[model samples]
Target: MDLGNKLYTLRKQKGISQETAANEIGVSRQTISKWETNSSYPEFDKLVLISKLYDISLDELAGITNINNKEINYIPIKTHYEYISKRKIGNIPLIHINIGRGFYKAKGIIAIGNIAKGLLSIGLLSIGLISLGPIAIGLLSALGGLCIAGVSIGGLSVGIVAIGGFALGIFAIGGFAMGIYSIGGAALASKIAAGGYANAPVAIMQDTENIKTLILNKLPNTPNF
Candidate 1:
């Protein structure tokens, strides 16, 4: 039989009233009546919902078995929109351009992926205000392999106040540090410096009191010792 006849038969078999079926599927009773009488057709999505509701196969509902040797014509759904368009969530733009380093193309307020750039970015290669990645670059504080920021901490760091394996800044601290005030295994500074092998204008070999005195003198306005 046809789709309308099939729907009517299925609803009757399930012992559900037209009004009940319509309410269940978010439609009016008149719409259900039209489907039962073959006066109107349902959308593809609604048809799928109906199929599930009736516990029947789509092929069975379309009367495919009854039309043997009859070539069926198919029509495509038309839409005026790009399938793969850029989308946004709140103030953040979410884009994925699959070109050279595609993940690098993604930018937003808070981004995360292979490569990202945002206010707080986190990825393999990230750049932002507070960035954390294998190769991260931030304006205030950074943590990564090769970091550069106002206060940097990573394997190789360079900033005003840096701390890492190989650090270079005004006040550096690391395995190998070089700055105006340095402290590490191999330390080198212009002024007061201290470490295992310290080198500076005023180097403290193993004097804690003198080191504190120099740091305090250099940063007189510094608080909380």
Candidate 2:
């Protein structure tokens, strides 16, 4: 078989449209059609990309037969998986999950994938009302490595009430915390601060030098400092 026939056969076996193949190969659909019809041939770089996209060897793509002059058998590999629930909330699906070799974003009422955005999202990078992932941004609550929300809890957190290794918010609590009312090992606040090392107008800490107004005993109707 010729190079054009080999290309056509491989593309057919993969069950992908010419436009999809063209997009992956960084070429036009017309160019792909020309190549398949033997009107044009792919450059070296495009051939390499095509081989990788089809999960085939360069030798096989070029129609290089074995020592016995026999063609190699090719198998289609499933690289992507996606699912959308029949149940719908308005126009959006109730749940959508898309995961694969390339970047696939899942968007629905409840989405779960590599990258997700929904009412309740869970993924590596997510955004929702309630999000849980490595990096999350939630309107109400977020819990992840790095989080931003109304109430956030993570390694590095920022929210109205933030809790993490390094936290910054209206009410912050962490190893290094900064806010109006801060509480941590190293706390800095404008109003009130309570920690081992605290700095604020009204500070409750053991270190008197850092405290502007030291409160030795806990104040009435105040949290335990």
Candidate 3:
């Protein structure tokens, strides 16, 4: 049966009027009527409350046929930055390039794979640089920004090299922003750039060439991803 039919049956089964249900749920009697008529759907939290009131599980309340409704599977595909709430540290929003993956034993904080990925990218850059391959060095440099973070890394050389046909004067290193723009320099970045990827400060740099993604680090809007 539909939601309206189910609602009507449930209300009658409880021996309560729409007015009583509305009052208990803190909504107007008209709201209940509209719900029964299927004119609208209940808000998520309200639905939860209503389920509890009726002593029913959410799926039961929504009349779901499937037992397992694993909705809202969110894997963050972008970079996030936030302020350290306690102190107003000029709070340059930070992004992790995800170099390696392993749970932190102490804090139990998930690095979200950024640090691990970043480290791997940098490692490739080192190998390429050592082999005197500018193309390989440029490849890692472009994808290396998501791996860049921490003021303590002050001494780490970001060895950025742009690989494309564009002249050097057009692009210069400007922190993470500079690193992303260099994406087009690598042969792979070329495939990405051709697809019309615009340049933005990258929060996450996907596998693309000459295409740079920029993630702006706003103070309060720091992303959990």
Candidate 4:
């Protein structure tokens, strides 16, 4: 069935006119009419609101292609290192953690093509925009939308980081989250690596001990880990 038919049927089921649906969804009646005529589809956010209005799932409303009740496109599995720990793919060695600790899980390790990684990559891009705010300002200047060619256009100098403005406003949110995750992961990796090195096997441990003993015997408190 056409989306328009669905929309028309849903409206009648709810006993509301197109005008009422439009008002509730913050769109014009003509837009609803257009949708009902199969001339266009609702924009994504509006589709979400419409789903709620009709008390239907987004998959049902949008007619998701081949969607199934058990389809798990975005399951957030915890650090089950078994999934990460061992594998070889086309001559590239796989990285792994010791189930409970290591660098392998720092960046949310998972099967390749994980949405979490994609989201992180997008977040990096949004942050790159902050660090690229000068370009946005230059475009505004070119549009003659600024007071002068480059006057207070925002996101200039200071390395594209405008303290408080539209250029970096929303991106700052994801940027902060990314920073926290990255820094936390890096720090945890450092600690785990340090602990691992301290507890390495006898031969490697002997090498480390020999190196440390030599340093201590020849030099006092002058070396670092």
The candidate maximizing TM-score is 2
Better of 3 and 4 by lDDT: 3
lDDT tens readout by residue for model 1, 20-67: 887676555666897788766666666777878888766656665433
Worst ten in a row by lDDT for model 1: 76-85
The models' CA-based lDDT, in order, is 0.72, 0.82, 0.38, 0.37
TM-score of each: 0.51, 0.62, 0.30, 0.31
| lDDT digits (tens) for residues 124-174 of candidate 3 | 222211211121222233333221211111112243333233312123232
What does the lDDT read for residue 34 in candidate 4? 66
| lDDT: worst 10-residue window of model 2 | 210-219
> Against the hidden true structure, what lDDT does model 3 obtain?
0.38
- Of the pair 1 and 3, which is ahead by TM-score? 1
Candidate 3 stretches greater than 4 Å from native: 66-225
lDDT of 1 at 77: 21
Candidates ranked, most accurate by lDDT first: 2, 1, 3, 4
> How many clashing residue pairs appear in each of the predictions shown?
0, 0, 33, 0
Worst 10 residues of 3 by lDDT: 103-112
Model 2, position 74, has a per-residue lDDT of: 39
Backbone clashes, candidate 4: 0
